[model samples]
Target: MMRPIYLLLGLILSLAGLRAQNLTAPLLSGSWQSTYHNPAMVHFLPQPVTLGLPGLANDLRLENLQYKDIFVEEGGRRILDFTAWSDLVDEQNTVQDVYSFETFGLAVQRGRLGLSLYHRLRVEGEAQYSRTLVDLIALGNAPFIGQTVELAPQGEVVSFHEVGLGLSYALTDKIAVGGRVKYLVGTSGVQLAEGGSIQLRTAEESFALTLEQDVRVNTVNALEYERLDSFTLDYDPTRLSFSELTGANTGLAFDFGIAVNLDRLRLNASVVDLGASIDWTEDVSSFRFTGTETFDGLDLLEDLLRDTISLATAVDSLLLTYEPERSTAGFQSQIGASVYLGGEYDITERLTAGAMLVLEDRLGELQPAVALLGRYAVADWLQVGINLNHRTGIRTNLGLHLYASPGRVRVFASSDKFFTLLSTGNTALAGVRLGLSLALGQRAAERPGRSRSSFASLP
Candidate 1:
């Protein structure tokens, strides 16, 4: 029975799960892709009619954990080492990944009104964990004899497709406002519900193990259990039906944005996924767990990770002591939201410098970050930019963004991990956005020495 506690703590952690702010997406200016940053951005687009062929973007963030910080070379082989990185972990660490695609989209501009209709598919998931848990697992409980280490691993994943209608209007050529209404079709998912978590602590006397469990999980064909020892959390568990994956759930969300221009200075503000929530109603189940037990032998947890005890033995032993309660019920969950506030100053006909303040809601906590960036148009067909973003006690990130428009076809890409491409990086944050579209309109003739990339005010 005591060994089961070790099995729960030692191994369930190595596996992976924040939303990262988009600092460079909007700088491309005058493209269908840029409008996603802030719907009001449509007012500054150079083309009259923009048709989105198809495009997708991925934003990823892993805080307080980095590959370079955890791995080292030993005997010509890469070894798993956490000696230099564990202490730097935050009280509540996060891993967020967001992927979105604009399947079919269209934007039309007329006099003072801009209208758009599009279908976007988005899949977002995040995991939030406590640093105390990592410390206890890596350094063991000897560091604090009288203190109690309390922590739990938490995460959620959700997928959905949405059809959105957006509208933008210019009060004056210098000021524009926009909003979007989205109807979401919820898909299959698994999420740790609110008021659900487990705490583990080690007592000084006998070095006893005290694990307090309080876990409630909501599922939509993502989790199933015949018994504690017989369960599956895989993507397709054979129990999932098509109705649960296609239209078993539903949600609603709204987005609003405003863009203002004053001479060479431009200001933009927007909120995404505001008041977004989904209700899982079909093929749903809830698992409720609440209990506490004190057993001697906190020191045996490390050995549990080794082959000393078979997993079957540990799980069966755990079932003898702990039994989770299960029921058929529906639960509602929210899709987190983010707000962006930024301003840019034109340094030259082809250069713009800006700063952005990003605020994101993780579960229920508010996290703030800042970005400083600049964009330049090398020529009418190419634009490039650089960005530097920072967070306290986490890490500093540097990135690049680019946009190219050859004739009526437009393409763009952005990343916060120029130092770490794809999934490789020494920093705590890595993100990339790539997409392509076609601008269908008469190309604006270039003015003498002025650049077409210049977000010229609406005429």
Candidate 2:
């Protein structure tokens, strides 16, 4: 019951946000994996067949907050601390979360047509809040003795699996068009309704607090609540079932892209995750908290120093101060979407440089980012590259990428925020992509005078 809420509050307050970029993946035009960012890149997939084994890409875009601001070491133990959040919090804040893993994949070419099939797991998380919300909860009513605090706390966590099919056709050597269709199976989620809110007011004369709540939250097999003398909700994320993963929650999404190839330059554009929404129709619970109560009870600072309560627990209790109206209802939620416009030029037979502008819609806001990348094909079998990015949360992010096709086996790894690997406490964004695969057919060769190899060529 309360434990789930407490942990959830901790998650939002200590959020490590997500903003992802695969700056190098898309630059390998001849590799089948490059199509992940832009479906049209499929047109360049090396002849006959390319088989994918296993891969994962985890990208994060952190803004306005860091790991240091959320947790502190105390009494030889690490605990969630928000005591000084007033200086660390922003007027409005949002965090986006996503993780992707490809389980299996295959790509085949027939003349000017290319087809691909892939299965992947996708996890998404989101949370939004106002500075006043954190301040009132962490510091309590003393600072707001004569003032009113408006609180807006929103968060969501959802996970699903997708099986997809993609197709691309090269209308000409210089132009290509492609699209992908995905079938999704949702496993679990906890999400808030659009524009939910709460308010608290402390009287100037008596300092009494009046609290109001008007928020709706939805759950899809995310929590199991038990009511006894005390309240508890058993929440164990590890308890997963294969059958439920492929159960009643399902949806479809599409991705489309176009690529234009010039003698020494390439122009690309794509809209990814279009109409990407999931229908949560099973084990669904809806909660509506629209009540007003005279709030009394917890003192945050005294309770903590006395080792009696925590800020997360206090806020958890505050949320349940009023009973909520519950129902069994189903709903739909859309995944975040992004658009990319890019251009790359071949500086030399072995060197390529590129730039891209991206606009993504996350939590009802459009975030913009720009990236520059340079790659070198050292030989037909080895390739290396680097990327520099300027996005909303960070000023500059340095990246490294490497892919080697020694014989029929291909090994690859990349990152646009390699700095985060050194210290998560110092960097706001952290991400990396690792992959291993095989290409059994014609081992991607070049024309007598042209080279399309990502790695340094091996005789």
Candidate 3:
């Protein structure tokens, strides 16, 4: 029972770490976009509480994931939920845990074609904390076992800075075809922990061990030791410092994507990100706690150091030790699609209403989501818009878009959870959107002699 409890505690912590992984793979069917127009940068930044599109007009290029609905059909939610919890234990052993937030995207319209860009921010990951803890445990024992322990530990934080340039040509009034070339720049900070430690428990307790280090990790140095002897001793608490146990390095990486779309119904497919990798700068750290071994049993001092040294060595070994000037990192996957449903309708002479059903794929899994968009022309100079979005579970989103023009200013905000949930602070999201977009370019056709049709002509 005690063992089960320890295992349960470890499992819980491990699953908590999985929150980071869940944050990395984003789905397009969420409602926050009405306020920010993008979901790629959702990890690090707060939702765009304000829209700031009014100042200038130029192209903003940005570059930018799962499945299991089958179970939902067969009442598999409970099963999946149980499995997800069990899987959390398995995930605990993995070396990387990635999370993301603040995802936003935008597209520009030009005649028959539209160009767009998006980004995924705050993608961070590191070697499992449990592995670090384990490594420290083996280090305290030395020659009695006449063995050495080695591990290759690594970690990093990266953002998928993506740039996509798209072109669409309208084949007819209601039908069009388009494609885009996507580019990704991966910026990351990395750390690697590697080293070895040995301990002599007792002569009669002759146990020898050697653990092979993983090849992918770049460990700067290894600890070598020969045990002397053992004796009883009191524990000492003065040797721990947080600073010596950590280090970090920074760098960059790359990826590519291509997508295509059609009219009121858009079939957008692309390799979300391709050929992403991480290159780390080297930075190293080392930890040591020395004391007399207890002959009367494991000394309290020895036991504490045993625990401390294991953690210290693992952390120091895995962190950025060499500290390169910079490093690079990112993830790669195959092509996926988002089928967009246009939600535009005229409710009255001065009002228009629209909605969209968004279906998308991430890393091979499919997700279906829906959105509602409404615009009311309060006057020639002012317009008010509202958006409602829903995807999986009971999560619902609401957004408001307000525009005041001459200079054409826009302010917006949205909630990613039910209003009641928000009021109770049960969800992670809160607040409104406020932003502005200015039309800085005028077409020659809108000047005087040229008709608006000239600008509207098929591409």
- Better lDDT candidate (2, 3): 2
Error of 2 at 381 (Å): 2.1
- Order of all candidates by TM-score, from best down to worst? 2, 1, 3
Per-residue accuracy of model 3 over 221-299 as CA lDDT, tens digit each: 1111222211111111112223322223222322222212222222222222233343323322122222222233322
Query: How well is each residue in 250-344 modelled by candidate 2, as lDDT tens digits?
Result: 99989899877676677779988889999999888877768666644444423433223455355445334445677888988788788888877
Give the 10-residue window scoring lowest on summed lDDT in candidate 2: 447-456
Instruction: Predict model 2's lDDT versus the native.
Output: 0.68
- Give the RMSD in angstroms, all C-alphas superposed, for model 2: 4.2
> On a 0 to 100 scale, what is the lDDT of residue 26 in model 1?
60
**Which parts of model 2 have CA positions greater than 4 angstroms off?**
1-8, 11-21, 228-242, 296-322, 424-429, 447-459
TM for every model, in the order presented, reads 0.83, 0.87, 0.41
Per-model CA lDDT versus the true structure: 0.66, 0.68, 0.31
Estimate candidate 3's alpha-carbon lDDT, on a 0 to 1 scale: 0.31
How many clashing residue pairs appear in each of the predictions shown? Answer: 2, 14, 78
- The predicted structure with the larger TM-score, 1 or 2, is 2
Which stretches of model 3 miss by more than 4 angstroms?
1-157, 189-339, 360-364, 403-406, 410-412, 418-428, 431-434, 443-459
- Give me the displacement of residue 318 in model 2, in angstroms: 5.4
On lDDT, the stronger of 1 and 2 is 2
